[model samples]
Target: MDWKTITQIDRRYLYIILFIFVSIPLLSPLNLPILVGEHAQAMYDTTETLSAGDIVVCSFDFGPATIPENRPQAKGFLFQARELGLRVVATAFWASGGPLGEDILRDVYGSDFPAIPEYGTDVVYLGYIPGNEVGMQTFGDDTWTAKGTDHYGTPMADIPLMQDTRAAEDLSLWCEITSGTPGEQQVIQFVQGRHGGPAALPLVVGSTAVSVPGMMPFYAAGQIVGILNGLSGAGEYESLLAGAYGYPTELLAPLDAQSVAHVIVILFIIAGNISYVLTRSSGGKEK
Candidate 1:
C-alpha cells in the first residue's frame, strides 16, 4: 500500500490496533520482574514502622477519572494496613472522592476480608466536605466541625474510632491518594502543619504522574513522608502487599498486563522512530 494510503487510516484506528495488541499480552502471561524503587521502598518502610494499634488516616482525594491510577495504590495500602492491624480513619477530600473511597474499601476489604471493619470502629469514612483547603484546615483543627458526620450520615462523635479523635495529630500517619488540586497542599498546610511545625505526624501521598513535578518539592523537603506515583508505584505497592499476606498470584494478573503493555509501547515508539529515519534517508515519506 502507498505511504499516503497507509497513513490515511484514522489515528484512532492505530490506537485500537495497539490496544488489542496490548490486550493479547495481558490475556496471556508475561512474568515481568518486579523492581522495587526508592519511592515504594520508602512507602513500605513507613508503613512497616507503624506500631500495633497505631491509627492511619487514608485520605482519598481523587476523582473517578483517576481511579485507575490511584485505586490500586489504595488497595495495596489498605491490604497491607489491615495485615499490620493498624486502625484506619478514611476520608475523602473531594465529593467525588467519597464514592471512590468506598469502592476501594468494598473492593479490597469487602469480599476478601468480608468482615468489612465496622465503620468508626476499625475504620471510619468522613465523606465530602466542600471547603477545599479551608475545609482541610478546619478538619485539621477540628474534624467534627469540618465534617460533622461519617459517610453513612452518622454523627462523627458517635463513631467508636473517632470518639477520641479530634485532628490529624491523633493519627499516626495520613496516607493521601489524590489526582487534583487542594490535595497535597491541603494536607501539608493543614494536617502536616496543624501544630505549626510540620505536624510531626507522618504523611504519605499517592498521586498521578502529572502531579509528580508539583509534589517533588514536598518529598524533597521532607514535608511528605513518602510518595507512590502512577502505575509503577501501584505495582510496587502491590508487590509488597502480595508478599506480606501471601495474596494469590492470580489476582495480580492486571499488574502484569500493565507492565507488559508499557514495555510494548516503548518498543513500538523505538520502531516507529527507526522507520521514520530510514524512510527519510531513502527520500520517501514515512509509511
Candidate 2:
C-alpha cells in the first residue's frame, strides 16, 4: 500500500488519545481504595510499638531524587513519633536532604496536620552531616559530639531534645530513609553492628524499589527491622497517615488520580495485545 494508504490505516491517533486520557487522570487524582502492603504494615506496626517519651533518630540518607518515595515514609514516622509524644531527632547525610527533611517536617506538623510538635522539646533537626560511614560511626559513638550543632548552627547541647541523646543505644528506635549508597551500609556496619543485641535499637528503612532487592539481605539477616520501597509503598503510607492523622482531602487527590491512571494504563496494554493478535490472524489485513 502507498504511504498515504498506510497513514489512513494506522491508528496512531488512538495511542495519542490514550496517552492524554491516562495523563489527565494522573494530573487529577481519584483517591481510590488503598491496600496496605506487608512491608508498610511492618513499618507501621514497628512505629506504633514506640511509646511516649521514647526517642527516634530519623536519618535522611537519600537525596532530592528520592523525595517522592522517601518523603511520605518520613511523614508517617514523624507523626507516629509525635502522636506517641516521642522525641524525634532528624539528621541527614546528603546535603540535598537538608531541604527535603525540613519540607517533610514542615508539611506534616506545619499545615496539613497543623499540630506542630514542640520544636526544641518534641522534635529537632540535626541537619546534614558530611561524613558517610565515618559519620555514622561517630554518631553511634556520641550523638552531640559527633554532631556538635543543629542544621541551623544551634548547639546540640543547648537543644532540649538533644539532652538525653548521646548514642544510638540511647535512642528508643532509629529509622534510615535511604536511596543511594552510603547510609544503609553505614547503619548496618556502624550502628547495628557496633551496638549489642537489644542495645542496637531497632532499625527501619525506606528505599527505592530498585534498591529493595539488595536491601532484603539485611532484613533477612535481622539487621533492619522494617522497609518501605518505592511509590506504591509511599501511596500506602500516605493513606495510612491520612487515616491516623487526617490529611486535607485536597492532598489525597493525587493518590486517587494515580489509581485511575494505573487502571487506564493496564486497559491500554490489554487492548493493544488483543488488537495485535486480531490483526495478525487476519493475514495482515487492515480493518
Candidate 3:
C-alpha cells in the first residue's frame, strides 16, 4: 500500500476495522489475564472478610448513562457478597439508580445464580431516596427514615433484613457503585462521617474512569477501603472472582472486547505515525 494512502485512510475504513476488533472479542470472549488493581483487590478482600449474615449496604449512586461501566462492578460486588453469604441492603440516591440496582440483582442473583440469598429476607432493595446528602445523613441516622419502604413498597419493618438493621451504623460494610456526584462524596460525608472512618463502616467505592481520579484521595486516606475504577477495574474484579472463587466468566465479554479494542487503537496509532513519517521523508527527497 502507498504511504500516502496509509496516511490518508478513510475514516469509514478505520471505523470498520475498529468495529471488527470490538465485535469479535464480544461475540466470542477470550479469557484474557487481567492484573487486578490495588483497589479491586482491596474490594475483593473486604468482601471476603464479611461473615455470613453480616449486613452490607450497597448504594447504586449512578444513572443509566454509566451502566456500561458501572454494571460490571455491580455484578462483581453482588457476586462476591452472595458468595460470602452476606446480607445485602440495596438502595439508590439517583432516581434511575433504584431500577438499575434491581436489574443488577435480578441478573446476578436471579435464575442465573440460583443459590443467592432470597429477596426481602437476605437481600432487600430499599429503592431511591431523595434529598441527596441530606438523605444519606437520614440513612445514617435511621435507615427506615430515609427509605421507610422497600423498592416494592413493603415497609422496612416487614423485611427480615431490614427489621434489625436500622441504619448505616448497624452495617458491617458500605459499598457504592457510582458514576458522578451524590455518590462517593455523599457516602463519605454521611456514611463514613457518621462512623468516623473506614475502620468503623468500611467504605468501598466503584466509580467510572472519569471519577476515579477524584476518589483516589479517599482511597489513599483510608476513608474508603476499596475501589473499582471504570471498566478495567470491573475486568480485574471479574478475574479475581473467576480465579479465586470459581465464579462463572461468561459475563465478562465486554471486558474482553475492551482489551482488544485498546490493542487495535494502539496499532492504528503506530501505523499512522509511521505512514506520516514516510510521507514527509518522501516529500523532502522530491524537493
Candidate 4:
C-alpha cells in the first residue's frame, strides 16, 4: 500500500467533503450540543441582574462584514430584553451598523400576538453615531446633546425614552455588539471608564472571534461583566435563553453547520497526522 497516497488526497476532494459537511447541517440542523462558555454565561448573568423597565443600551458596533457573528448575538439579547420587559436603547456606532441594527431590532421586536413593540417607549433607535471612539466619548457624556435626533429623524424630544437618557450613567447596561473601532476598547475607555471604578455601569461585549483575546483582560479586570465571543458566543447565549426562558433557538441552523464543520476539520487533522506517522515508520522521509 502506497502510504504516500494517503497523504496526497486531492485538495478538491477535501473541499467537497468540507462543503458537504457544512451544507448538511445548514440544510437540516443536527441539534449538536454547544457547550456554554464562561464569557457567554457572564453576559447572561449580568443581564439577569436588571429588573423590568430598566434601560439597556444595545449598541450594534458591527457592520455587514460581521453580521454572521453579531446578528445572533444582538438577536438573543433583544429577545431576552423583550421577554423580561426591559426597555432597550438600540443604537449603532459604525456607519453601516445603523441599518443592520434596525433590522435585528425589527426581527426580534415584531409581534402579532400583542402588536409590535411601541417604537418610542419600548425601544429607541439612535441610528449610527459618527466619530468612532471620539463619537462614543461624546455620546456617552451626553446622548441627546451630540445627536439631537433618533434614527427616524424624529427629534429626541419627541421620544419619551430619550427623557430617561441624558448620558451613559442613566442607562442600566452597556451592550456593545461590536466588530471594531468604537468597540470593546472604546467602551472600556470611554463608556465604562467614565463612571466610577468598581461602581461603574456594567458592560457586556458581543465581539468578533478575533477580538475576544484582546478584550479578555478587561473582562478579567471586571470592567466588562460578560462577553459574547463570536458566533459561538451567540450560540451559547441562545442556548441559555432557550433552556432558561423557553425561547426557540433562532441561530441553530448556522450553529449546527459551524459545529459540523469544526468536527470535520479536526477529524481530517487527526487522519493526516496518523498517516504521516505511518509513512515515517515505513522509511518515508519527513519533509
Q: lDDT of each structure?
A: 0.77, 0.75, 0.84, 0.85
What is candidate 4's local distance difference test score? 0.85
List ranges where model 2 is wrong by over 4 Å. 1-22, 111-117, 197-199, 247-253, 256-287
Which sections of candidate 1 miss by over 4 Å? 1-10, 111-118, 196-199, 249-252, 275-287
- Candidate 2 residue 128 Cα shift, in angstroms, is 0.5
Residue 286 Cα positional deviation in candidate 1, in Å, after optimal superposition: 8.4
User: 17-74, model 4: which lDDT tens digit per residue?
Assistant: 9999899988888887789989999999988988999998999998798899999999
Task: Supply the TM-score for candidate 1.
Answer: 0.86
Q: Write one digit per residue (lDDT tens) for candidate 3, span 1-287.
A: 77555866778999999999899978888867678789889999988988999999888988989998898888889889988889888889988898888888888778642235588777888889999989988998888888778877788778888887887778899899999878988888877887656787888888898889988788888988888989988888888999988877654688889888889999999888777788777773311
lDDT of 2 by residue, 82-108 (tens): 777888889888878877888888876
How many times do residue backbones clash in model 1?
1
Tens digit per residue, CA lDDT, model 1, 119-235: 567777776777888888888788789878887888876788888678766778888898987788778887677655444677888889788778888888888877888777877
- Which numbered prediction scores highest in TM-score against the true structure? 4
| TM-scores of the models, in the order given | 0.86, 0.80, 0.86, 0.90
Q: Rank the candidates by lDDT, best first.
A: 4, 3, 1, 2
Model 4 residue 58 distance off true place after TM-score fit, in angstroms: 0.5
